[model samples]
Target: MNRTLHRVGAMCAAHPWRTLTAWIIALVAAVVLGGAVGGTPRDDYDVPGTASQAGTELLRERFPGLSGTEARVVVHNPAGGQLDPALLDRVVDALRAVDQVGVAGPAQPSADGDTAIIDVRYTVPVTDLGADAMDQVRAATGAARDAGLQVEYAGQVPEGEPTEGGLGELVGVLVALVILIIAFGSVLAAGLPIVAALVGLGIGSSGILLLAAVTQVSTTSPSAAAMVGLGVGIDYALLLVTRHVEGLRAGLAPQAAAARATATAGRSVLVAGATVLLSLLGLILSGLAAYRTYGFATAIVVATAVAAAVTLVPALCAVCGRRIVRRGRLDVTEPQRPPLTARWAARVGRRPAVWAVLALAVLLLLGAPALTMRTWPQDAGSQPTENTVRRAYDLIAAEFGPGAYAPLVVAVDLAKVPQDSVPALQDRIAAVPGVATVSEPLLSPDATAAVLTVQLEFSPQDERSGELVDQLRAETLPAGAEITGVTAVFVDIADLLAERLWLVVGVVVGLSLLLLTVVFRSILVPVKAALVNLLSVAAAYGVLTMVFQWGWGGQLLGVDHPVPVSTWVPLLLFAVLFGLSMDYEVFLLSRIREEWLATGDPFQSVVRGLAATARTITAAALIMVVVFAGFMTNADIVTKMIGVGLATAVALDATIVRMVLVPASMMLFGRANWWLPGWLDRLLPHLGRRGSAELDDPADAAPATEETASLEPAASR
Candidate 1:
């Protein structure tokens, strides 16, 4: 590890221009390639088992007469539900005149005889109702209202508009920039990392776009790539620049300081990047194409960020070397070490066991709410109340059947049984509970397959919908030999996700353990790290349940009522939070291991290590929390869940896990913390000699007999 760092550092010093030019060329190539192969934006629920995809397939295969599903429409009334006959005629005329509309109807009087509904459907595919489709729907609805009728537009297509916008990304970037500016207190220093982060994001996004041209990557790949890349890239650059500034404060010359910063901080970045990549790659075991694509894209982005951090940032610094230091500070004699970190180390050493238990108890309490977590299947219209589409949808649902907008597709095989058999099949399906109506089946052109449209009594977002799906898949479909359609696809996806969830978990846990083991050179270290990471994850899950599922703080957070968390949220949290939580574990333990190797006294090492790193870890955690919290401002439920989940994880990991639990456990375990079986130690590859020993006394370990005393932050730093 040291040798590689030194070599990279030396190359940077000798050929700064070459390093800078090489990265620029790669960046340009990535952009050009991306432009030639643009990416597709996908809805949040674009996964295979999602209702939209399944319903569309069934419509095409079994219900050919049905042009497409009618997910939503807008009805306009000049004075609420009452409309003049002439104006109503104009509204009907305008609605009928829309070339793309498949269905159009005037308000049908309700039992109360006060309100009316105007139903409309699009000629285009229902699956295409993202931002562009929603815009068109809005335009059509506006035209109807302008014709002098009261208009209330409600449907799934319009409901998803707020989420599809780039609101979350914008918030995250703005928050991060503000925080960085404050942290650095200089425009150049803050802007440098932002520039590096943007370069990483551009490359990562372009790479995903280019890859999508060949492979069927998820439409959500670009957004996920951009979000992940920005956070990680900025983080990597921060570590490097912080180290460089510290070196300057230590009175090292420009070239020498840059070399030391690269050799030390650069290696840490490499290890961190590798760990994050491996953890993300573990998502392939999910067996869901969506997750697989996400895993692949995220891994590519993290790798690119790491590369840019070490190569691009270093090269830039080399060119602008002395300017990085504050003016007239060439001979400043600031301390060479970190003092705030040393204070935390000494505090942890004082009562490790007491703090450890307290921290663990807090996490367990926070995680208690997870037991009540309910799963909500994908619904196109699940957004906050303040959203226009959701409000419009509620208005529509109030007038019509809850399931008036979203319907299911049922398919029957005609070749095996004959067209007459489909009626009986449809009758049987209609008899099932929750089936409000079943349209007659339409046979395919070849007469091999037919489809029926089934509208349920409940809304598509209701839990009853999933129950109905289960009944169709397990009871209805199996009753006949040759029946398959969108419902079947959804059932298949659900089964696949359930069966492979554990495999995904196992892969992530196993790979993460392996990497930690390799990095720390101890079996116990990896096990402890994994346990703490899981605890942090569980706590985050509990918080998610409370906020999203139980409606705690939902209104304040811009969430409307309580909704089941997305199925993908847990898997995403597991992968992302685990990698992020591991960051602190790695940072804290690496320093501890360094002290232990130098002092050879477990007790003293714990004190020294905590004192050396606490402040930096805390600062980093704060920055992450601020950036992640910004995402919560978005009205989208899924994005809000992710934002809250990440912020909670970082906060808990840093304060409870890093500051309290880790110190307490390490101190309580004492010598056992470093003890590894001879065979296992030999089996794992060592990262390198401890940095503390390397920087201090290389030939001698600190005396074990030295009185075990708390080292002050001043002494340690």
Candidate 2:
């Protein structure tokens, strides 16, 4: 890895303009290809082979008209407190004329006659509803407004989202830029990292768009990539730049400094990026389309960041060259001998057990609530009142039964049961406890299946709703019928996820452990890394449950009611957080191991390694936390939950896990931290950059030998 990075660095530095021109061409080509062939984004939560999935499939195949996205156009008179019947008729007429939405059920006025709700259905999925649908929606709402009534839209496409733009991302980047400037104290030095990161991510975005041609990609994929890519991308470059600056101060020539930095920090980037990629790619084991899609997209972006960091960053370093050095910065030659990070590391080494215990205590306190965390699908009920979807949800729950938001369909196999008993089965289902309303039976074209829609007393997001599903499936299902719907499918999905999540996690964790064990050639290091990351993930979940589910700070976040944690959140969090946290471990441990190998001293090595990487790691963590936190401002509830969860996990992992626990654990472990049995060492692939460098140039080992000798600590000497 080191030799490869050095070669890449040497080539880029030798011909910087060629490297720059190649990157520019690649970026432009990617964008052009992406725009030409990208698939349109869609929102789908289909859990295949589940009862609900079977029912929905049947509906789509047999009755396409009834299977599209549903919307409700609601009108209310605020001043008179009475819906004008004539005005509602006019509004309905305008809506009926709209090409996008087809009125489903008749206009049903509230019992009080003050408000009326019209059921409208779209022929496409909610995510597929384009500008034409919006224009039609505007026309319908305009009609209601003309009649001096309150108008809002709900269901298929939400309202009050004027532009669904990435304003939060822009704000985060701006803040991150400010942070970088302060951290480096040189505009050009700071800007190089950002530029490198953005250029890489730009190509990544285009790549994702092009991938849309071959498969379904969620609209959220780009934003998610942006959030993660920005932080990792910049950090990868920043570490290289930091090392290069140190190299220059060590009296290495310009090109030599860049090459050496690439040989060191660049190797760390490759390993870290590879781990993140593998961990994420392993999510394909989930066998779910959405998870697999997100996993693939993220993996590709991370790969892009790694490639650019190894190649483009070096070229850019050469391009900026001496211009990046300022009078008080490089010329002033700030001493790296006794950085504050090393001092903190020294304190930690003095009482390794004490610091380790304290960090564990904090992790336990934060992670405690995760044991009781409950996950379900989020509905509009949890949204703020100002949101059109929430308003519509509240009105339905108020005027109709709470279950109106989610009705379960009981699909009966009439062939399996006596066909004559269909009516009797419907009657029995309606008589079931907690069933508020049951629709008349609808027979399949062959009369072999009968479907009945049942509205329960509880909303789909309610725990009681899950209980209702369990009751019907276990106790109340009439001989031939199985309940299925949006509510039922989600319940099944949540249950199945709960059942299989451990397997997926085990696969990823096991894979990561094996990879790290081989890379680091130590059993305890991988074990310790996994344990700390797990606790960090747990604490992140606890924070999510507190804010989104436990209702600790709901109001401040603009949510009126506590939402159930999205069922897939924990699984997604586990994969992403584990990989990302491990990236930090890779960075820190690689340096520490490098030092240990050089100095043949464990205690001093830990201190020097910690001091060396701490500032860059902290800055990296800050950027990641802020970027993720910014995503919480999005109106999408799932995105916000993930945003908060990831931000907390990264922050905890970076500080508590990286700074306190890891160093302390290594300090306590001493020489044993690097121990590997002879047989195991022989079996494992050699991961040291020095070995790879020598292999690359059998006759060129002298230069690397000289470089290593120059890097020896003065204290050790």
Against the reference, the lDDT scores of all candidates come to 0.67, 0.77
Each model's Cα RMSD: 6.1, 3.8
> Residue 672 of candidate 2: its Cα lDDT?
90
Best by lDDT: 2
- lDDT (10s digit) by residue, model 1, range 76-155: 34355544555445556666665566656765554443345565655554444433665555565575556664455554
Q: What is the lDDT of residue 540 in candidate 1?
A: 98
Question: What does the lDDT read for residue 711 in candidate 1?
Answer: 14
Per-candidate TM-scores read 0.84, 0.91
* lDDT (tens digit, per residue) of candidate 2 on 606-664: 99989878888888888888888888777767677878888899899889888999999
